[model samples]
Target: MSRESFDLDIRIDPERQRVAKQRAREGRRLMLLELGVAAALVLGFLASGASRRLKAALLGAGLASPWLLVGAYLGLVLVGYALAMAPLGWWSGYVRAHHYGLSTQTLRLWLADEAKSLALSLVFGIAAGEVIYWLLRTYPDTWWIWGSTFLAAASVLLGFVAPVLILPLFNTLTPLDDEELVARIRRLAERTGRRVAGVYTIDLSARTTAANAMFMGLGRTQRIALGDTLYSQYTPDEIETIVAHELGHQVHHDLYQGLALQTALLVGALYLAHLFLRWGVARFGFAGPGDVAALPLVALAVGLFSLVTMPLANAHSRWRERLADRFSLQATGNGAALARAMTRLANQNLSEIDPPRWAVWLLYSHPPLAERIALGSEAPA
Candidate 1:
């Protein structure tokens, strides 16, 4: 059906719409399934007394140091969860994506990507587990506060380093070769009174057909990445509108604001986890809050807290996205271009034009397409 906005007419392909709805349903189900699996793993470990037995076994194996014991226990649990979840990950990320004509990678390439992701997870997971356990032992009275602060700082550090250190592990990134396009983007950033270090194109086409662009990093590390898929398809004007929205993030200092919000939430979640750890020492027969056996309780507490608070986080994110949209219009003074860009994005990305209200509350980090289009129409020319 052809949908009319004040400045543009956009058509939603009926078949694509049906496919998009189907994909959305499957994606939700997969999310629920992943959550269910995680909850079950943690709960089963606690209820079955498996955590206690595993810790005992590790101690018996002469891992007498608390740090070593905790590290080993966490490593085993991480491997077990990954093994259990691997099949589902493959299905959702590979099989289902391919079925929907979204994925472009061969199975081998997909598996390689998964392997790299798992390796990164295991490395970080084990390290974080070690630090967290150390904090639990050393700062038993206020580990939550200390741990949350450390994690927040670590998150900021990661943001600074990821565009350089971490992202290259997954895909190739090169300075965008188009001189005209680069100049245009740099000019857009200047218009917003900010400057990006560089404009780069990411090899997203190596993995999927979906189009995207992002403004990432902090300080000198700050840069913009346009997916090759988007670069190949979108016109310069449409691309500029997208870049303006990203520059909006920079101009508004949304990155720092978002980190602050995240830090606040992390404190809340860890505080909840700390309480659960104390309660678990009695309820689950753990020796103390520092006992490695009580790790499952921590996981359960943190996961549940995140699930409950996701809506609030998403609501804040949507607000920021709206501000960026308005910024894009104001900076570019071209609402029609934004509207057209959004129309293309909807079709190319298989975005659902009119998702349900509940989904928006729970899941959406940006306003729905119709709302964005209406906002564009109402923007000053």
Candidate 2:
């Protein structure tokens, strides 16, 4: 397609844009609602003396070891939290997606996925809680520093393993059989002075129609993964542009940059949590920072900290996304194709071309669709 042939105005469907806006709005509403519910639950647990009672009951049951006590407390807390949140999870994850005609998952499949997610969360959450409480007990005054460091290390470790260990649990990933396309992508990587382990297609169509492409893993594990919906629907040039964008993330080391950002945020949040714990000790008569009953305070602090900092993190993310978009245009030298691809993606993925400015400021992690399309249209080939 010629540069002049791609008309930005004509490519957008008005009805689709309307649906996109509604979906986006509702999605954000659901997120905020979930957060509110979580905060309320934590506060209720503390206010009602439920957390204290639970900890006391466990201790009275002859759970003598601190490790065992922490484990049991976290397990019960996590289970209770999960049970409380399950209704909202169903509404947001399953019902809402189905209502929007976005989800292909049946109730059974959705439940199965939720089960997997809950199991993973329990394992990780309990493990992290144990380590954290241990640190609190051992280093009451400076546990935040050590805790943040451990959390930072864990984040990076997850980054390296998630693509291989975690992702495969949810979706089947197999090598893309399109030999010609694979070669084209390899050449694209080569042109950027990089190599990929392989090109794979993920089973996105099984769950949702949202098209996406990503560079997965780090170092020797690095590979390109194209959503099946993307591979089946988009043209080679369009896919090339999308893959180029993912490559930009790799080339710019955005993953490492993100980890660094996360480490900073963790330190800040943990410090805030420490302060909250100290206040809980004074106000709520908690034993100390190591008190299991004060866990809710730690959660409330960390959650509030994350909620407050979300906009700043999102702004940083938007900057990276803009850089990636620029890289895609420069690397592919197919601005027209990129524009067309974004147009199709907006429609297919139900993205609002020009979202409200407030949403852009507070929620968006990428430049709005209209801006990306314009960038592609204006790029010099």
Instruction: Give the TM-scores of the predictions, in the order they appear.
Output: 0.95, 0.95
Stretches of candidate 1 off by over 4 Å are 1-10
Tens digit per residue, CA lDDT, model 2, 1-381? 112233334487889999998988888898889988998999999989999999999999999799999999998998899989999999998898888887899899998898899889889998999999999999999999999999998887888888899998899888888867777788888889865457788989889978888877877677779899788777788888998998898889888888899899999999999999988888987888999889999999999998889889999999999999989888899998888889888988898888889888888989999999999888877
Residue 112 error for model 1, in Å? 1.5
Backbone atom clashes (below 3 Å) for every candidate: 0, 0
Query: lDDT of each model, Cα atoms only?
Result: 0.85, 0.87
Q: Among all windows of ten consecutive residues in candidate 1, which has the lowest summed lDDT?
A: 1-10
lDDT of 1 by residue, 267-314 (tens): 999999999988879998998988989998889888999999999999
Clashes by residue pair, model 1:
none
lDDT of 1 at 32: 93
